[model samples]
Target: MVHEPRSQTGLSRNSDTEEIVALAELDPESWSAILAPRLAYFAAVARAEHVTRAAHQLQAPQSTVSRALVRLERDLGVDLFARHGRTVSLTAAGRTFLATVERALGEVERAAESVRADADPESGKVAFGFLHTMGSETVPSLIREFRADHPRVRFTLVQNYGEWMLEHLRSGELDLCLTSPVPDAPDLVARRLDEQRLRLVVPEDHRLATRKRIRLAEAADETFIMLEPGYGLRRITDDLCAEAGFRPRIAFEGEEAETLRGLVAVGLGVALLPPPAVPRKGVVELTVTGQRAVREIGVAWLKDHPDTPPVAAFKRFLLTRKGRLLSFSPAGV
Candidate 1:
């Protein structure tokens, strides 16, 4: 007969010791595949210290529980329980293993509960995105109206310009977005919710300030402050200027409309912009006449994306508000 090596503790370094060493070296995925399903069974038996009692607690047959425990011990290559008459006590290895098992089970339970809470119909979360211009009033009004009926629904709101929000929608970061010029793309579903007439904003003392309406061509020679390129408003402004027969002389490129309005207020330059939520003191907003000087505001989402209950409900509400989405009138309109 071949004899295996023995440790100083007099325990033989046999196949069990080899197996235990191999298990300890396993990668997380391999360890999970081997031990995950058996962890609950081992924990229950360890807790009750009685196989029959543990089986009853687990609502499983005693024989099945016994077989599972035996297989678990065999797979682990360690005797976890010291068996007595109809009862048991944990070996040193079982006690050490139980601590980590309990924590893992707790983390798994918490993760499951978190997802359940997010999926709850009455109180789920919606990842909503919109333009910076809408943040001050339009979005707040919409959310307030929505919450009056769905008091428990939650929203994760993002404010950015159009194309950025559209990218977020495509990447699954956003559930839905309100954008302008109404994106025409194969991967997106877009709807024109409303149209906001663009206005020519000028300093109070500028030549065109007193005019109620003017042809866009009249501003051909004037310096313009525009939203930086890649912004939806910037694209719309460029298109409108092109139709009016001249490329604008851009003096400053900015991110926010309010900032551009501030520049216009100080006589830096004129701008083609949407109506401010609150009219500024030093800028006169005139209607742009003769051409289609309006931006079509729309809601967009991924064509194939499936929405959670709260997201779906909010989308339905948005669709119902078509043509009336931007109900508030701009200054001087």
Candidate 2:
């Protein structure tokens, strides 16, 4: 089938106006050279229809604008404008090209604007990790309030435990973290948020459940249901028992706080836990003494990266909000 190029000027309209055209397809590199540079210039020239006027607006010489048009025509292998006396006018092709050029420029501007906003502290994605204890009580409220203030920024929460969180924070896999204080590692900066006591979780009906507080020495002989090894809570529980001069008898081990609480609820055994938050429906909290057992829940990140614009903004938000809730870190200049 024979096909002819469509004309943009009304003067060139014919029966072949709807024919398939090769000028419609352009390679990426060719498109960059022909359509990217001086695109605004083309729109300006197309609008004014005068070389000197377009040149004045572009802050370029008339010849420079003419040369850019020549390059564009060469790239497309078609005449875009026609020379009429000393002025130029759009050819059939120039009119079609102008529409596409204007649309593309608008899209590019929108993309640039989005990138700028995401790079700003007030807007972006904040990837963070936190411990389950804080996840239940503190982190959720912090996130809700932060979102309310800065709706453009997004928060992604990762639930993690122990030193694995520290590893992820330092390696850049995590942007920020909330965890109980671990042994200080070089280059890892932390803000101690609050101290929470480790309490014995047992069913409300259990014999020792009536006690407000008991020495860790008293529970040394009881079988303890605990989180698996490596959780910060488990380590604290194990360390407290060791400090009391006996290892806890492990009846069962699990991961979720609710599960461990449930095991304790059934009178299976008591488990050492962070200070109770939800009340566990039927569980009771017994404070332990002697060990003076408490863990510092803090916001931790790599020292160097903590000061980055987005990270710093989030740190400030967390610190300010945390201070109002329960003072956590020492503020330093």
Candidate 3:
């Protein structure tokens, strides 16, 4: 099968167009020469079709503009303009090449603007990742407190499982994450955030609903409603059950913790869950008395990643608010 070269508009550019594109890639030094001189002079002349007018708009001399266009053509090994007396017009090759160079220059401008935004002290952005479980109350409360002081600071919030969030942290897509099992990667700097107590949630008519506190062994036979596997909370539930000498027989598995709580409320099965900020109706929270009935949550970021002002401010804010939640960090930091 024969494959033809395609341009930005998805149209076949034939041999000459392919040569133009290849020149930009095969000889990067030449491409860099075109870039190092800045494409503004070429772009102005291309847009106006007159070197003298382009020089006037640029406040540069006509000779300088002419020299720049000649240099750009010479470096790229393509004729970008056809001159007739004082004015110039784009050739077939010139139109195709200009299309590529305009887009490249536009991206360079956008990149500059984005870096400037990231560097601005008062109004920069932070890409924050946290567990789906923390999205309802814990994360919002913290963000509200932080925004009270830095009102213009922006956030890009991502909520996912610990494993997925950690991947984003490593890829530089996320500045920081609130996650559990506090991944032990050498590339990450993880600070113990808080440890949440897990409660054994029983339906209203279940055999053990009347009990205030029960060791996990008592529910050895009960079916469990739990978050799906690969979740940090699910790992804790499974570990707690294992320590109690039983593997959980799952009744229902779901993405949301509240949905699992709702299933328990309807008497589908009992679940091991963290207490809701507001207790859900029709379910009773039983304290799980055991050694492994808690999950560790921590803040992790790529090691040596320099934080922008907003990211630094929010990290400090999170570190300082130690007593706001019922949970406490094992290391207290």
* lDDT of each residue in 249-330, candidate 1, tens digit only: 9999999999999999999999999999898999999999899899888999999888888889999999999988878544
Model 2 quality (TM-score): 0.62
Top model number, lDDT: 1
Q: What TM-score, over all chains together, does every model reach? A: 0.80, 0.62, 0.79
lDDT for residue 152 in candidate 2, whole number 0-100: 74
- Full-model lDDT for every candidate: 0.87, 0.74, 0.80
1-333, model 2: which lDDT tens digit per residue?
A: 965333332122232222214335645555685457868778888888877798899898877776666556655678888877557788889989989998998998999887575557777767789877666657777777777877777766889785888888778778888887644777887777667767787788988888998888788778889989888888888788888889889999998777898888888998888765556677888878766788777787787663446666788887765435443212110
Candidate 3 accuracy as lDDT: 0.80
RMSD of candidate 3 to true structure, Å? 8.5
In candidate 3, what are the lDDT values of residues 1-333, reduced to their tens digit? Answer: 988653222323344556556665766656575455748888888899887888899999876776666656655667777767667888899889789879988998999999789757789998999987788778887888789998888899999989888889889899989888878889999887677778899988888989999999999899999888899888888888999999989989998888998999998999998768666789998888856588777888899989888899888887776445434222121
| Cα error of candidate 2 at position 60, Å | 15
Clashes of 2: 3
Best by TM-score: 1
* Collision pairs in model 1: none
Better of 1 and 3 by lDDT: 1
Q: Candidate 2 — which residues are off by over 4 angstroms?
A: 1-117, 306-308, 321-333
